[model samples]
Target: MQTLDLAVLRTLIAVVESGSFAAAARRIGRSESAVSLQLKRLEEQIGEAVFVRNGKQMTLTGAGARLVGYARRLLDLNDEALAVSEKSIDGTVTLGVPHDVAETWLPAVICGFRRSHPSATLKVIEGRSAILQSRLADGQIDLAVVLTATRPANALWSANLPMVWIGRSDFHLKKNEPLQLAAFDPPCFFRAAAIASLEGADIGWSIGHASNTLPDLWSAVSLGLGVAVRTPAAVPPGLTVLDGRRGLPDLPPLHVSLCGPPVEFKKPAVDCLRVILEECLAVSIHAAA
Candidate 1:
């Protein structure tokens, strides 16, 4: 049997992720025909079909599923090997982040990181906390900046964050009334906390509006759509805390931290990247305060 080629393996992984040969081609900056040819050659080496295609949609066969895991490990190892020899603070760190956090502090963090490690590249994916968590589990991201963290696990980085509710000073609170809330959809940790607090307080409340997008929700809050529960760092311009009002029991502090393969912890590139992330968090706290 012929030896497996890493390039071809990487190509296959891309195709599986991208969902089509054409998409994979675009991602890798190769022609579709070239990607198809690579897949053909890869299958020949494996002695079985690696993909099942029906029209444009493709699914990984059992063999392809097995190979997918191996391919990611191989690529990670490939990166580590390259990093070892270079011994330079230069490489890419894919980060999954929350949208509001990205809007507020990511730029400063990126700028600071670049000044210190110009060659270190950043690829950011912005989404809600739950989505970011899924990406972290899948190895799609090297590190994540999230609201909460778990115990020191084999494949996790954890930290506790003190979060707060923010609103415009003009936002009025009726004494003994339910708090009006502007929030995102379900599974949003902050939103869940806000709702639970109001209900627990037996305060009469109403939803001003809801959104799946952070910008829309922010706009709602800015226009006094309603008050929102957010991290201190995320209170937008022209907003202030509604201090006299209290809802629910004390909200659990948000935990923000990073998680990735334990092997990455040993890599200098990963360590440098983590420092950049921690720096970002520090700036966030200071700016919010």
Candidate 2:
């Protein structure tokens, strides 16, 4: 446990950010065995294990998670120090991310790209999936990350994500009273599914809050305005996910898709962002599982 080498630190960050050593290998252009051995060496140097295997997945220990943020900052500084001779991957790439993902996974993706492609700016637009899709089609954004019920053939990658009912801890439901809901304006993936579930179950409901963004909806929920649907991983601090026993109709899982006709993108700026975003999202989807 002397000192953390720059190469090892980046490798450690890759494994945690990519959710698996194999995925990390692809991210860093290394073989799986190389990544594993590097991790082993990192453990020997630190005298503490960073990750624990869970069935086929690799879950970060508490120590590992703490190191992830530190590793990112370290690597960013490392890159900054080495930036003089490197060709700048600098450009503004417009990206649209779903509201849920923007809350949870988007920040890390932004950080990774900032560290790895410092001058390349990701100008983001956050909205409901449908709205994002429309913006993508209109070329208002270069890419869209959507939560969709069905996987589209053109999706670069996608993963199943479970969503839940969420609100303040003290929020309660009355059997005879309409279940109030807080959600984004219409054409939202969460809103549509939530509304459908209530309708299908023949539950009486009212819209207690409707906003254009996740924070406002969350603020409404926190105020005891109404319950809302969200992924457990993205639930705002102080909000509690409702248990099935709460009797709110269940919401189905959805796929988070990176909008793509992958072949259409050939620029380094686009490719770099695509890979960074993919890695960021992989961690989010798997960790939630």
Candidate 3:
């Protein structure tokens, strides 16, 4: 029996994610026919069909579902296997990240970096998007991951962060009552968004608490200080997403972005880090959404 091709497995993963052979082709930089041929070849190699079409949706067959899990594992091993030979990468690379992501989404990036560049040093600076973006532009960091309400032109990669209203379970908003809020410190997108959304809806609001970090914010929120906008996926365990029946204006999906130079100084190493972080964030945000 022939060995499973890594390219085919990656393509298959993309197809499952993209929901169609054509979209997956676009994602993996292959022609639709090429993707289809690869899938056929994969099925031939495995001696079982992977995907079966059901009405408008192409659902994965039992065999396909099982292989999907294996594909992810193999892909990671492939990345590590390749990174092991990378020579003499010993520079200190500064990575600026939002505080929220530093807690929830950064461990994967850090683990991948440590595995791939054992000799390299990574300095992390945590702040809000405005501060991170400014630092990136000023060359204070090699790259910065930030959250934005809209996708910008230079975003290396962008993913959806689902925004939700979060508050205590029994919290209720009386008619035209000022929206009590526990806001993140200045330079926070969530705070600005919540205020803008409330004001646009002609809703009065007051800042009941201000927090500089996730723990403080979570604490303030859990204490029923006020309602806040947060990405439910990254929200702390105690807070619950407010019911949509509350007549609150819908918050738009936050665009999580990675920003780096047009040409990184450490091109090869930086490229490796970028791909790892991008894929990690993609899977994370996709799951959250």
Candidate 4:
């Protein structure tokens, strides 16, 4: 039986991610013809077409999508085995994440990293985006996942996430009354975005509840105390997202960025964590979409 080649799998991933054979060649530093040859070998070995053209874009075939997932696991295991042979990743790695993200997607990332680098110590700092960004800049944290209106200079991965109004399903807004807002305190990105969106549409609003923690804000919104602006990823089971049809102004998309220290200051453990974060978050985004 023929076996899949790791080099060909890498070429497949590069093509899928970069969106074209030429782009993938540039990314992996190979000639376009060589990239094509690698993909041809991959298809020959698997006996299936790996990609199909859709309009102006190239997308993975069913078999290709399945292979990509296994490819990632295979590559990760291969790399980790090599790294362990050299030296175990044992140094401390500090990661900072905003309260909302910490509640939603961070557990999987932490668990995966710990399992992969059992000897490495992980320190997680949870706070608002501004605080996390400040800590990252001060070298208080080695990596940060923060929400921003624009892309950060040091971002490793970033995605524009749509903001929604979250509140109890039964909650109703009385006409002419100020929209009751539940959000984090000042210096908070979500609060500012919520307020800005409201003010832009000349909608009167008042902070019915403010807290430094996401749980408190979620609790307030869930209890029907007020509506809170946040990403859909953070919406709890009891709370529902409000859209324009509900007479709420549309909140702008916020960038969820994974950032780290300068290139010179980055460590191997930190780099490993970065890859995990990006991979997990990319899955989340696709699932959400």
Candidate 5:
């Protein structure tokens, strides 16, 4: 086996980014022939061609595309290694969180973390709670905030927060008009709960709109399209809570949990992030209460 050269990797990345050998050579401060030779040697070592020739253009072959992805990540890792050698606590923490939570809660949480540990970078991936949970289970992120019907596996903290029913302030209905809802598609706890509650109450209700994403659904609700079920902390601005004339049960509170990959949680950086997230969660829960 032979050693892989960082110079070759750098050249490959530059070529990919620049989209041509000449441009790559110019960007990396190397002659075009030198760049081409480095790529040929890299391909020989890897036993595959790294790029497809198209006149003056260059594109990665399937194997080449995959290798470029790995090469880019390796370069990023090398950069981080160098950065961490000089700076304290330098690394990336990928966090998975729900969309609504990110919109309402993440800025404050990130601001606090950055203030305390400026060298540690944060990357946030926002999606539905279920998707975030899957990513956490796969060790794709350092930590996550998720909602589950029951206790989440291997979690450090859990709290129940009330989900509220809200409608636009300008919305009007006949005396007997039942609540109509704008909801996300299936696998959404809020949507399921809203439907279950309305059906159980025998209200004359219907699905006014459905969105594959939360922001769009919230937009629809804010436009007086229909009522929406949301966590109290995330009630859209300018919306009013709706109530049944007869006493009705508050929507079941969602169980928010703090979780991470089991191994990563042992690191100090991960632990610091855990504490920060828990503190933020506590403040949010209290504020909503």
Candidate 6:
């Protein structure tokens, strides 16, 4: 009986996660032609086309999607078995994540890390991006995922995330009234960007609510208290994204960066978590988009 090759499955996953064969090649340290060959081999073994072209992008076929689900579990178990056989990786690795991200792809990262490094202790600290950055700088956390206007010098991975205005589905703007806004407290990047965009557009606005915690901010927005500006990653269930059609000014994109200690000070477990963060975030954010 023929079985699927693990290396080919890994290449398939890399292609899906990175959104292109070229990107998958770069990610997996293989030549572009080699990546293409592996994927072709996979299709031959599976007896189905795995990817179909959608305009300029390649998306998974229905069969491909189901296969990817199986691929992930297979790889997870394979990695777990290998890690258990090798000298076990053990140490406390603290991860810092901003409130927005903590709600979205963070859980997958946590689970993936735990599976591979079962002996390692993982601690998570959630706060605003600024606070997370501070904690990383002070060695309070081994790694941090933070938002910035520009990518930092030592980012392990970075992506530009578009920001959007969000409010309750039925929320409406009153004509000739100041745009009511709900957001985090001062020193928040999203809040500052929202205000800057409105001011630049000469749009009249006033803060309807401000809170330090994301849940409270989301609560106010969901209650139709006001609209809040944030990345599309973690918009609450009841809220809808507002656009130019809603008379909301377009907000600028923010950089999401994964940062960690200098290479000299980095531990093996920290490196493992870093890989998981990059892979999971790349896949999750791309799917969200």
Candidate 1 residue pairs in backbone clash: 147-255, 148-255, 161-254, 178-203, 178-204
Per-residue accuracy of model 1 over 13-81 as CA lDDT, tens digit each: 878888898777556534455577778877888887888888877888999899899999987786566
Estimated TM-score per prediction? 0.61, 0.72, 0.72, 0.72, 0.65, 0.75
Which pairs of residues collide in candidate 4? none
What would the per-residue lDDT of candidate 5 be over residues 1-289, giving only the tens digit for each residue? 6977655687788888888877775565444555677788789999998888878877789989988888888867765654553345557888888866776667656755665667788899988888888887787887888877777876788898878787776665555776667888778988888778767767667788888777788888887777888776655556766665423335777788887767544555677677778866775565564
Q: Residue 271 deviation, candidate 5, in Å?
A: 1.2
User: How much lDDT does each candidate structure score?
Assistant: 0.69, 0.77, 0.79, 0.80, 0.74, 0.81
- Model 4 residue 125 CA deviation (Å) reads 0.6
Give the poorly placed runs of model 2, Cα more than 4 Å off: 1-88
lDDT at position 66, candidate 5: 88
lDDT of 2: 0.77
Comparison by TM-score, 3 against 4, better one: 3
Candidate 4, residues 39-110, lDDT tens digits: the string is 877888888888887876887899989999999898788667755633556799999998777766676577
Q: How do the residues 1-289 of candidate 2 rate in per-residue lDDT, one tens digit apiece?
A: 2677666687787777778876776676444555677788777776778888878788788888887778888877867765662366778888898767765667667766776777777798887777788887777888889988999666888889888999888777788999999988777778888989999999999999998877888899999999988776655668888977788878889888898546555466777788878876675565555
Candidate 4 yields a Cα-based lDDT of 0.80
**Residue 200 deviation, candidate 1, in Å?**
1.6
**TM-score: which is higher, 1 or 5?**
5
Indicate the residue-level lDDT of 171 in model 3.
Answer: 80
Kindly provide the TM-score of model 5 when superposed on the true structure, using C-alpha atoms. Answer: 0.65
Model 6 is weakest, by summed lDDT over 10 consecutive residues, at 25-34
What is the TM-score of candidate 4?
0.72
Best lDDT among the predictions, by candidate number: 6
Q: Which residue ranges in model 1 land beyond 4 Å of their true spot?
A: 1-87, 149-159, 175-178, 245-250, 263-267, 286-289
Clashes of each: 5, 0, 0, 0, 0, 0
